[model samples]
Target chain A: MIKARITVTLKNGVLDPQGKAIEHALSGMGFDGVGQVRQGKVFDVELSESDKAKAEADLKAMCDRLLANTVIENYSVAIT
Target chain B: MKSAVVLLPGLNRDRDMIAALTKISGTPPLTVWQTDTEIPDVDLITIPGGFSFGDYLRCGAIAARMPVMRAVAEKAAKGVMVIGVCNGFQILVEAGLLPGALMRNTSLKFVCRQVKLQIANANTMFTRRYQPGQIIRSPVAHHDGNYFADAETLRRLEGEGQVVFRYAEGTNPNGSINDIAGIINGQGNVLGLMPHPENLIEAAHGGSDGRALFESALGIAA
Candidate 1:
């Protein structure tokens, strides 16, 4: 079994309102020197296939097809 | 004029859309369910608002992949008119039937109110009833109505006049880029917008600022 992790994040130049709100809230709570806060989604998927390369490719297709909105977001696949 | 409404589970605005199409077109629109793979011939196909699948994963993400959307895509490819409002807009974008993505509101809060909408391109069949540069009122209610696209795509949309509606003046409720409220597909038949034009089609619902849109799409004489 191969387990894969997918992280979907808003691409640079795309506005992140939720992330900005979180950043503001952290500052309101007195967290100092907080830089830009960006929000993203993570998915842990398991595949019965034992091939790491094939699993990674499948995960990427999953992101391209459903897991991420490629217009405004980018995703990374990590197999462990 | 014949029209149809796309129906999916957890959507609350199908009734409103049906009523609007019926009243405007003088014939009830066929309702295409999520599981249905076939949609009968119709002039306009509308996808209404409200949460679908509780908006899991992302707004319209799950619903966009349903069987009905495939049929919708097929119809759209054949040059049928398709309009998606609010969450409907999200679904169209998610389904890749339309350009750009509807992100969370800039305020991070659900916005439900009226905003002024300018007819960015009145030349399309959907907006022919409205005069060029005409401004009308539209009601928007959604948590994720902010639209985003790559700079290249944005440039093309603007250059091709695919942007059909823009928030007029300073009523940019969700911080959408270029204050875009509605857009049409590159082929010009499919439209996706955040505002609820169906909700304001009659006098009882207040001024009929949105009636012209339905009239145009339904081929009714204004």
Candidate 2:
């Protein structure tokens, strides 16, 4: 089995309100020098396919079709 | 005019949409389920507001991939009138039936309240019953109602007059870009908005400001 991780994140220009809230909370708790914080989502999947390239492509398709909203976010896949 | 309401798991507002359509059109709309690969003939198709698929991953993300949405998209492509309210709007965006995306509210909160709406464009099939630039009241209840579109898409939407509604005055509940509350597709047949026009369709719901939308879509004048 091949295990992969998909990371989905808001694009740079897209506003990250939840991340901003977290940043604010960190500052309130005295965490200094925290310039910015952006939020993202991660998904882990295990594929029975023995071919690493095929598994990677399938994971990318999954991200494109379901794991991410490409209108405002970007995604990347890593196989472990 | 005949109508139908799309249903999916975790959606709670299908009945309200049905009730509104039934009372307004004098006929009940058929309730279509998620697994149905085909939708019967209908003039207007409405996707009601609610947390479909438990809002997993993102509001409407999972539900947008269901067979029913594909059917909705097919019908929409054929120039049928489609209206998606709140979570329905999210689904439409997720399904790529509409442009842009809805994000977490700028306030990072679930806001449930009444908001004043301005009919941004009354020339479309859904707003012809109202005078241009009319101000109306509608209720909103959602956590991720903030609307966002990239610069080019925003320009196109405005240039094409696809923007149908805006939060009137200071009632921008979720900090949507340009105070946009609702928009129609380029073809002007699919409308996806975050307000609950169904909830305020009559006096018993506090006002009838939202009835003209149904009237216009149904081709029935008030």
Candidate 3:
């Protein structure tokens, strides 16, 4: 089995209210050096396919079709 | 005109949509489940507002992939009028039936209230009952009502007159670009909006400004 980790994050220039709230909370708790906190989603999947290359391609297709909203987000997949 | 409502799991406002359509069209709308793969013949299909799939991943992301939506898309492509309210609007966007994406409100809070909306275009099948530039009141309830699109897409939507509604009097509830409250597809057959016209269909609901939308779509003049 091949395991893949997919991370999805909003593209730059898109406003992220939840991330901004987190950043504010961190500052309120005395983490003054924190400049920004952009939120993202992570999905870990185990593919039954043994070939790493094929698993990676399938994961990419999944991300494009369902896992990520390409209009405002970017996704990256890592296979292990 | 015959109408139907698509019922996705976790949908809360399907009943409201049914009631509104039944009262207006004089016939009950057929409810199609999310798992269903075929859609019955209907002139109009409405996607009601609700937290489908518990709003996981994204508000309408999961619902957009449901089997029923495939049928909905097919009918819509053939010129069937489709109206998506709140979560339904999000689903249409996630399904790629409409442009732009809905994000969390800029205030980082769930906003639920009646807001004024200016009809940007009253010539579409869904807005013909209203006069051009008419301002109507409707209830908008959602956390992710803010609409975002690329600059080029925004310009194109404006140029094509696809912007159907705009928040009135600078009351931008969610910081949506150009204060857009609703939009129609290129063929003017699909409309997606954050406001719930289903919640405002009768005088008991404070006003009937939303009724004209249904009446217009069904070709029934008020």
Candidate 4:
């Protein structure tokens, strides 16, 4: 079995309203030292197949097919 | 005015969309699952609002790459009318069917309230039922409903009159660019918005302004 973790984030240069809002809120809360905030998602998957190469392929395919939006979001996978 | 409503695993508003469509068009729409390989032939396709895939990897990101979305995209290319509400709107943007992205609210909170929207472009399939510059009330409930695009893209959208709705005066609820609430694709066949029109279909459900959107699909002008 192979296990993998995936992280997804909005591409740079895209405005992150949530992060902006959090920055403002933090500032209002007196946490003035904070400079920037960005949010992301993480996914942990366990594959039953024993072939690491096949698992990586499947995982990448999943990311390309449905797990990530390459336009505004980027994704990376780490396998163990 | 037969329609098909796409249903993702975590979709919660599919029933509401079906009910609203039935009331306005008198024909219940077919529900297509995300994993389905084929999209049914219908006059319109609706991707209902919900936390699809638990909103795990960004709203609508996962659902955008679903098997059914590819078919939806193909149908959209053939000029099939498509409407995506809330999370579905995010999916459309993520899938490249529409421009811009729906970021989190500028307030960093899940905003749930009735917001006033001005019908910016009444020529599309969704807003044809509304009068030009008409003001209507609808509910917007989302955490990432802030819409963003590059300045050039925004200018083009404005020049092309692709913006369908904008937040009413003094109501930039999500801080979207120019207070945009909904937009249509360049072809004018596909639309994506953060508000939930289906939830406000009946008078008892706060208001009936949402009925016009469905009615427009049936060629009825409000």
Candidate 5:
């Protein structure tokens, strides 16, 4: 079995509304000096039976097929 | 009257959406799995709410890239009505079928409750049943329902009247700007909203305001 980790995030230049709201609220709470905040997602997958190379390929396929939106999101995978 | 609902692996409210469609359209809708490469022909395509792929790597992130979404996007471009609720809304946004993204609540807490929504734009196919400035109640359950957009994008949405539903006054549950509960694309074919209209199809569910959405779609086909 191979274990793989994936990360997904919104593409840069797209406004992150949630992040901005938090920034405002934090500033209101007197927490100034905060620079920037971008949010992303993490996924862990355990392949039933595959070598590292195959597992990485499968993970990338999953990202490309359904896990990440290539238009506005990017994904990366690490296998162990 | 053929309609279909896309079903992601972790979808939990598909049955509810199906039930709503059956009751409204007098037929059970077809279900298209995420792995399916083809989308069945239908007048409307609904992406039901659920933790698709366990909401991994972000809500709706995984499902947005699924094979079915590609088909959904293609169909949408041809002018099929696409409605996405909750996590489905996230998927639509992630798929770039709609502008903007749903982010975590500013409070960082999962919100689950009935929220009041104002019908901001009643001219769209998904909202023609509603009267302008009317208030309706729908249930919202999610951790990331905060809608985000750039200033220019927001202005454009407003100018084009693409903003469909806004959170009612004094009930901005998710802190969405202008209390936006739902929005439609410029073409007005695709609609995405955080609140679950599927959950409020019957009076027993505490309200039937959501029925209007289904009715509007049916009316369009009729």
Candidate 6:
């Protein structure tokens, strides 16, 4: 059995109001030297396939199909 | 006119949509559940507003994968009319049936109120009853109605006249680019909008501005 991790985040130019709010809250709580905080989602998926190459491709397809909205978000998959 | 409304789990506005379509089309629209894989023969398919799947994993992410949506997308490709309102609009965007994404309102507040909309294009079947540039009032209630799109897509929409509705008179309730209130697919058969036209179709609701939308959609108006 193999496991994969996928991280989805808003693209560089996309506006992230929620992340901005979190950044403001952290600064209010006196966390200095923190320049920016962009929020993202992470998913840990278990694969039944043992072939690392096929599993990596499948995870990418999963991200492209549903795990991320390519218009505003980007995702990266890593097999562990 | 034959029509159907797709019902997803947590869809709170199905009844309102049914009532509106029934009153306008003179026929109660067929209600198709999300589990259904096929949609009955109908001229129009409406995906109504409400918090589908409790708005989890992005507003319409979960509901967009329902079997009924597959049928809806297929029918839309064949030129059947599809109207997606509020959360429905979000679903269409997430399902890749429409361009852009509905982000959280810039203010990060749930805005619920009537807003003036300008008819951007009245040549299509969905907006035929309204004069171009006419101002109409409709209620918008959503926290994630802010529309976001890349500059190229926005330009393409504007150039193609796919932008069907614009929030009027600089009354930009959300941070939607170009103050877009609604848009149509390239084929002009699918429409996704943030406002609740179903709620404003009766005089008892204080305005019939939304009635023309139904009338145009049902092909009963000049």
Question: Which prediction has the highest DockQ against the true structure?
Answer: 2
Docking class of predicted structure 4: acceptable
Ranking by TM-score: 2, 3, 1, 6, 4, 5
Q: Candidate 2 vs candidate 3: which has greater TM-score?
A: 2
Per-residue CA lDDT of model 1 for A49-75, tens digit only, reads 988888888898999999998888899
DockQ, prediction 6: 0.75
Q: What C-alpha lDDT values do all the predictions have?
A: 0.93, 0.95, 0.94, 0.87, 0.86, 0.93
**What is the full ranking by DockQ, best candidate first?**
2, 3, 1, 6, 4, 5
Please write out the lDDT profile of model 2 over residues A4-27, one tens digit for every residue.
899999999999999999999999
Instruction: Name the runs in model 2 displaced over 4 angstroms.
Output: none
Question: Over the full model, what C-alpha lDDT does candidate 6 score relative to the true structure?
Answer: 0.93
Instruction: Please tell me how candidate 3 rates in CAPRI terms.
Output: high
lDDT of 3 by residue, A1-80 (tens): 89989999999999998999999999999987999899999999998999888898999999999999999999999985
For model 6, residues B73-151, the per-residue Cα lDDT tens digits are 9999999999999999999999999999999898888999999999999988899999999999999999999999999
Worst 10 residues of 1 chain A by lDDT: A50-59
**For model 1, what is the error of residue B53's alpha carbon versus the real structure, in angstroms, after optimal superposition?**
1.3
Whichever of 4 and 5 has more DockQ, that candidate is: 4
> Residue B4 CA error for candidate 6 (Å)?
0.5
Lowest-sum lDDT 10-residue window in model 1 chain B = B19-28
Per-residue C-alpha lDDT of model 4 across residues B157-219, encoded as one tens digit per residue: 999999998999987788788999999999999999999888888879978988898888767
Index of the highest-lDDT prediction = 2
The CA lDDT at A22 in model 3 is 97
lDDT, residue A29, candidate 6:
97
Indicate the residue-level lDDT of B62 in model 2.
96
TM-score of each: 0.98, 0.99, 0.98, 0.84, 0.78, 0.97
How would you class the docking of model 2?
high
- Stretches of candidate 4 exceeding 4 Å from the true structure: A1-13, A17-34, A39-80
